[model samples]
Target: MSLTKDGPTPPPATARRGFLDVRDLVVHFFTDDGVVNAVDGLSFSVEPGRTLGIVGESGSGKSVTSLSIMGLNRGRGTKISGEIWLEGQELISASTEEIRALRGSKMAMIFQDPLSAMHPFFSIGAQISEAYRVHNDVSKKAARVRTIELLDRVGIPSPNTRVDDYPHQFSGGMRQRAMIAMALSCDPRLLIADEPTTALDVTVQAQILDLLRDLQKEFNSAIVLITHDLGVIAEATDEVLVMYAGRGVEYGPVKELFAAPEHPYTWGLLQSMTRLDRKDQDRLRPVLGSPPSLIHVPSGCPFHPRCPYDAQAAPASREIRPNLIETTPGHQVACHLEPAERQRIFREEVSPGL
Candidate 1:
């Protein structure tokens, strides 16, 4: 199936604008060194049958946001706030037992590394069956049949026999597919995939993305796809949320953001991507400098230290943090640059190089 932004007509909507809504979410880890603000005042929403891609460099709090949404960050030393509304149910205030019951039924997660996520000792069928049995009351024989069907649906060959194989027996791609199957076992309404294509070859990555698109279409599930790969975002997501230093710096429809990104950090990210369409033989340009430490994040705009255009905003960019402001109907950006100036820069300077 084509992974285009356009897809089948969605099911009728309710009064709510988002099937999954996250508002001003904050997640901090109180380490011995200091409090690490992993996710700070981040907000976004996803409607059913639409995929929202969260992209950022490492340490930008992409995974932390997903984990927080899944209620997997509950423990000592971690502090979380803000609202996570799934189908109008508030997840942050929900009890641990409530969240546990909701997982794999109302929502599910596909972890970055399936090899580590899955238990090595358990057979694939046993694991999937157990997950199914948790949210569903079914006989072992019935659960096993459902497990085999899921394995088959995910394109594992000879599901009847392969279901008995251990996680160690599967290839990286196969393992990832199995993880997807497990996440979809209960036909959840929301799915979070964290770096699902990591460590896979290009062919396998494409296949996985295609499979995700097909499955999303089939299930009409709201998806949060967290990854650093811009190509994947462009290919599979209806919207994109660009994170920087634990906050969203830019967000909009995927195509529009790619066409005219408003933030300097976003320009840097696009420049860093290896473009197959460009005619020049120039070397790939990377976004200069490493990400900032979350424990002691830079004052004001967290990205100002490395922003090439920070001089445009001068001390203001250094003295004050910018909140996301609408630059267009749906596009929002957190930058001090004037909207007109941003467009001029992208058109005259950044676009040619990109």
Candidate 2:
């Protein structure tokens, strides 16, 4: 995906343009302590044919950013700025009515927890059909047909009988597949999945990820996947956005980022992934320290406090916040130190074997 301005409009038509284009998006919440910058100056684009992963730790603005795009954070004392274009329409300034119309039809979200997303009282069929009926002026029978099809499409077995089951009746993995079915009820152009496989076991997680990939190919919908798991990003996304302290510290192709991570934060993330060397296998080396509070972030680099490279014998790594500079053709990094210097420190002082 060549990200040239001339390639496509901010939000092209559903048939002609890209699925989503977000530019300089800012979401701030008013709290007693102060303003919390949940999403600060984030920019990215998602074409209909590909998936974009927003990976970071909790409070890294992954979920908040996706919510902002879906118009789900309105009227919650949240102030938003910047442009969010969906299928050529600007969602930022769109009326509540307009956004409501677009919610499950043109755009839909599959939340992390299926138990919470589904209504306890409503049967799976009822909830799924309701999603379709809310968007389209179809009869209940037609919506039921669509609902059953979606359930089957999402790999749910016995869709005919299971559709009548309640949320609690289904297992964890089944409930998640049901949620994906509901989100895809209207054949949405964009699917925003917020940690879709968070609480599931490893086997279930792999299944869900595979299901998502297959669905994307079938529906050709643009996906915005928000997750803390780098492995998920590696498997499912075409592009990766490494966010830190509400800002996009790095963004590029998934393979390139994983192969040669430019940002120190990204490097930290890669290093933290679990490694297997032999039959015994070793435990994962987790990233050190928690993220800073959004209310009172650090002055220079928000990640400077926890970054190991900062403590090394390098002056440029400690003093100033590095701008996200284009180090390579498509690789971008926000480090004051040169690429050669950072790579040297990362290979020598940080992860010598990597």
Candidate 3:
């Protein structure tokens, strides 16, 4: 990669893209043991007023991709490549100062844990106002007003009074709401929510999702929501990206993918989720085997070890890595199984249970 003091050299100009477009992104951690390929050649895009859900097991590179986009994957042992474009600008090639300027005002993140993310000493309002002041040329009083407005907008009850409460003072749901308020303090055009509903009760999760939808409608912002909940993906996202072992295995429109998923990995994920509609289901069908080690990922198809249909592809599945190919207009999957065989299995075996 070409580099100067500023940062990595920008790629040549390309055609106009979505509000946020990430292409062939790769993230690796040069640990003492070996290089951990946290993310490998993952690509996705989110347009204004739309949400993209990334679902996968732990250590599946979901969070790494988000951090890479936010420019938080910088350190001694970390390396990131590929393009992260917001609007017409390339981010991976941008300078530290440039990334810093865009972080809050142009793009912001609602982190998974609010308690650890927020300062214990500072009041909720103080933190939000401080973030607002950093980007906007406003007095403290004006910033405070904006904070309250954001808090109220995000459904924080009695925002004017509760704004003074510290992070610990708020419940888990409230803390998440506060985090959302803080993320939107600047009306950022792109929002990255890393497990925004994690740890909250079911009702609270639904409320948070609703709040996000409302906010998206109001601001027309592009959102990247990282979560393991397939239900959340079905309910909130326009598109779903199923990841495994640091790579995207299936990606497509949420409704169609969920209705008739193609990849065996995607089928396993769907089967694993608890279904309230299926009363006959005595137990959840968990995906067999464990995720592979990123440092020494399985050869060929990373998920072949656990894939029930691996025998169908046989030597190819074990010998060569499958490239992500478009099975339909906008849906893609990475697997060795023939499209006809995949559709047959899904139609005969998977759809009945689901």
Candidate 4:
């Protein structure tokens, strides 16, 4: 797919290199039960034209981290602290008005559900054009033209007439395409896609992923994809972040992390995937137990309770809460066990086939 030159001028060289940099991000919600730490000291960066996938099980703070970046947690008795830098500008310290200006213009998020993101009252074209008009000083006619162009660019057929139809008039895949068109209306510098293909069929999921890849290449936008699916991360991302119990336990290049995952939680995730691929008679290797409650997390390692290797037999693995150490170049893992021991477990216990 060819690049698009529809939006604002690109940032200068230095600024463009680090498009989105998040550091030590923490988000906590106050509830009657207790304070729930949704995101605890998470950090990552996405350079221009790169995709970073944040993967984990449900309630692992993936969505919370993305929403924190988008400043969507405001006014909810939620406490957030950390640095979210978009081209060196700090998003955490930015005021509501400032973040509002940046959203949908400099950075836009494609929600998991298109139905929730789109307004049922307005036509698809009107919604897409409105996104453009909100950021750019273009006339409605010009915005409408841009909207049609985006619709066609996103692989929607008969966009000229389809643009006039409301959200309910389109099929599930069409709605997702319309959502993508709206997200790209102002040609955002960073795109945060939170499970953008969740509700679609497998064929539609592939189409949406392809569309996102094509659009990212065309616009030169940094993308942060938040999803639980390893297949999606493996296929669509350059780097991966594995979150567990509100903290990042493993992070590195996709290839390195997949080949020799050091974290026990990551090993569990891989084993779970392997079990899914095995025959029905094969015993499924689930992660063992449920993730600990955020309100009252376990001591030492957050994943200790469910960790298969954190026991007497695996004495080395139960030592302490491991810091995220670099096991190899650009590959980091949080585990107490030695590299060789971890490798042995990952190869034999987790994935014997590999």
Clashes of each: 0, 1, 0, 0
Candidate 4: tens digits of C-alpha lDDT, residues 90-198 = 8999999999999999999898889877999999999999999998999999999999999999989999999999999998999999999999999999999999988
What lDDT would each prediction earn against the true structure? Answer: 0.89, 0.83, 0.88, 0.83
Per-model TM values vs. the true structure: 0.95, 0.91, 0.95, 0.91
What would the C-alpha RMSD of candidate 1 be, to one decimal place? 5.3
Model 4 ranges off by over 4 Å: 1-17, 274-280, 312-320
Better of 2 and 3 by TM-score: 3
Clashing pairs in 2: 12-17
Per residue, candidate 3 scores C-alpha lDDT tens digits across 79-158 of: 99888889888899999899999999899999888888899999999999999999999999999999999999988899
The per-residue C-alpha lDDT of model 1 at residue 201 equals 83
Task: Write down the worst ten-residue block by lDDT for model 3.
Answer: 1-10
**Candidate 2 regions off by >4 Å?**
2-18, 278-283, 311-320, 347-354
**Which 10 successive residues of model 4 have the least lDDT summed?**
1-10
Candidate 1 residue lDDT tens string, 209-292? 999999999999999999999999999999999999898999899999999999999898888888778767766778899999
lDDT of 2 by residue, 1-354 (tens): 433221113333333434588776889999888999998777778999799999999998999998888898986779999878897898999999999999998999999999988999999999999998998899999999998999999898989999999999998899999999999998999999999999788899999999999989988999999999998998899998899988888888999888778677887787777656523444455679999899987766788888776665246545555556667776667776668987776667556544
Off by over 4 Å in 3: 1-14
**When superposed on Cα atoms, how far off is each prediction in RMSD?**
5.3, 3.7, 4.4, 6.2
